[model samples]
Target: MREDTFCWGIVGTGRIATIFAEDIQQEPGMEVTAVVSRSRDRGHAFAQSQRLRATVTDSINALTSSGNIDAIYIATPHSDHLPATMAALQSEYPVLCEKPMGLNVAQVTALADLAQKRGVFLMEAMWSRFLPAMNAFMTLLRQGAIGEPRALFADFGIDVPLAPDSRLFNPALGGGALLDVGVYTIALAHKALGRPTNVYGRARWTETGVDGHSAYTLAYGSGAVAQLFGALELNTPQQAVLCGTQGRLTLQAPFFRPECVSLTRNNGETNHQYHPVTGNGYGHEAREVADMVRRGRKEHPTMPLAESVAIAATMDELRTQWALQYPDEP
Candidate 1:
């Protein structure tokens, strides 16, 4: 432990939490000093497996009030994100909650309001926003490397076994293709085009009554458009393309965490750029939270609470169109 270490208290000992613990260790001044899980046994196992000299407890209060932790990372299931994040914010601890933030617009809006009232640092762990390649990609777009953005295309898809009770398919767990992997596409489009003026979408539901596959189009007032897709039962190419008046930029497969991008001009010329990731690419966001907290910043500029709210609202509209509602949503 160094004198300038930034300590984290992680909630949930699941896969995301484990990855975060492992990646944070790669950062010079950051560490996961404590963790809380629904099961104390699991918490202990997570600590030992990660070889972390940290505390393992089942009480979020104890972890938050430990006096040594600088922030809290909530990696619970989608349905549990709101409650877990609320607990951390109520404790006045900065929080980095997992993506989607909550199951619906209302839940996410409430969390944003609370974080504002409490004046604590709160960010959605949209790790892709902090990726080196993503930063470069955004930079090129901003610099007009592709000209005025006219349209964008992105998708995320995976083939997972059907399990009604699993996190990815369970209605009780707030499961669906839209929330599970679709958020990356939505967020990427939001970053590139801001809020859309109109959205049109439809979904294919699973036997469990959740969306197994979804596709949507977002239209902007400036005539910019984004076509996005997400699926749990189909393995669609996980790539993204942004087209403009002068050229187009393509992010390779798995665009969410892509390392390479190519820009193609109308003149039939293309240029490739690569920006390598660090430590599974999770540490970059963790470092951002640490840096923001150390500087007394309330939120990260790239991933602000307002944009999160708007993204949630966009999903809310789509769900409204599909007549989809989670068991936990009011």
Candidate 2:
């Protein structure tokens, strides 16, 4: 490990954690030097699977307090996000908590306050924001290349296997299509068209009481509207469209990490493609976290602490509309 490198203690052994470990090792200036799992065997197994030459611990304290660790990446279940993040914050370590940072807005706000008091870097790992194509897409929207963006449409739905114990359907684990994949649609739409003034939504609930499918609309004060939806039982096209007065932009399927964008101008059939990223794209966010910490910044400008809470707030309202609540949420 280079002396100037930032070392991350990964606090989860799930799929997300695995992807993070695989990607981070490929990047320079940062490394995942430790892992925290629920059980010793899980921790060891994860470390072995990742082929990491680092310490593996089952306790958050052991990993968070390590002198060699520079930050903590909370990739645990949604229900574990708060306690894991709080522990890392209390230990004076900056954190990159995965999206849906908490169960609800209140939980997210508490974390923001804690991180502020601790004066450490805290960011919701909404990785899409940092993708090169996303930045370019934002620039195009900002530059008025598409004229006035009046409406947006986005969706993220995967046909997940219905296993009650799986995080995608487990209420106790803070699972559902909304938190698991819907946040991406919300985050992207909200970024392109500021916060909405009103949110209307409906959903189909699983027998386990979690949201199985949901559709929602966000109305902005500027007359911009966003129609976004997510589902756990069906697979939609997973694309996103931004329509403006002069032209339109469409991020193809898998919009979250899209590699191609389509721009149509002046109602003509003329189409243009913009491709602007390489690799799995998780490195962009990790790179941002490293840069922010290096500059002693408490939060990233693109994905601030406030935006994280606000997005969760919208999800909270949508859940209310559906009358769905996780058993573990207070």
Candidate 3:
């Protein structure tokens, strides 16, 4: 663990991978040193475009065993995260995998256990948890700015075109509205409130048997409930609302990357808070991973391993209720 700069290797060249790679370049103590893609040409092209010296390789074995990369970021499809993380773990490399950590709870538990036993750092890329505004919102909640939170309403849905062959509709790729976007809504609910005691969900499945729309309700022990919805067939407001005894907080578009929030008091007075991010919000998560590695920590304090497991478990339960089984799930 060096104090100066941490070397990173990207495991995929997808859209998310490109965004993260660009964000890494902006950070001071982080650099993307390598990229692994199934196509060597694509890997080389992505690396060159980023202006980084990369060892392009089509083989995961070669990329992991090169002994030149510090941590590997898994940006592959949801179904591929497990295998990719395992490949890196086998080579004694730490991993920061994209969320929903695995296709199911059992797989997530297995991978988390393996990483722990191997004494390697493993983190889920739930970028929302590392954002500045989210941190401030949590702080405000803790300080009783919103009083005792009673309910949370959040929705994240996009107008994804219906294509049976696309990953969004392919059951084999762990495609669905829940795993694709609902994970963020669930995470937000969990962050604001603890794990729910009762969970119920209703979903509309696509022709290929994948969920295109899902609405879930989670009941906590304190009689608080979280209402969340995710859909690929519709364009939702993509907002988040936290209601408490004294006031309510509302976030604008893209609740996951919210830049502004409004708090309404019991007296009907509203106060708006704005946080301007320095670079793309992705850099915050990258800096967090770098700092964690520098401090010799295996998991982030904000996004703990336990939280990842719990979120997976919740998603697993919802999928089971909706009969949404992916090809990767055993």
In model 1, the Cα lDDT at residue 204 comes to 95
Among all windows of 10 consecutive residues in model 1, the one with the lowest summed lDDT is 59-68
The reply for model 2, stretches above 4 Å from the true place, is 269-271
Cα lDDT tens digits for candidate 2, 1-330: 889998888999989999898898888878889989879899999999888877988888988656688878999999989999999999889999999999999899999999999999999999988987677778888889899999999999989889998988988999888898888989987799978889988888898888888888999998999999999999999999999998888887788988777787886765656666555678889888988888999999999999998999999999888878878665
Where model 3 places Cα greater than 4 Å from the true spot, the runs are 1-3
Mind sharing the TM-score for model 1? 0.98
Superior candidate under TM-score, 1 versus 2: 1
Tell me the lDDT of candidate 3.
Answer: 0.87
Question: For each predicted model, how many residue pairs clash, with residues at least 3 apart or on different chains?
Answer: 0, 0, 0
TM-score of each: 0.98, 0.97, 0.96
lDDT of 1 by residue, 71-147 (tens): 99999999999989999999999999999998998999999999999999999999998998898889999999989
Order the candidates by lDDT, highest first — what do you get? 1, 2, 3
* Candidate with best TM-score: 1
lDDT tens per residue, model 3, 1-330? 345678899988988899899898888878888899999889988888888877888867898777677789999998898889888877778889999888888878878988888888899999988888888789888989888999999999999889988877889988999989999999999899989898989999889888899999989999999999999988999999999998998876789998888889999999888986656688888888888877888889888888889989899899888777776466
Ranking by TM-score: 1, 2, 3
Q: Where does candidate 1 clash, by residue pair?
A: none
TM-score of 2: 0.97
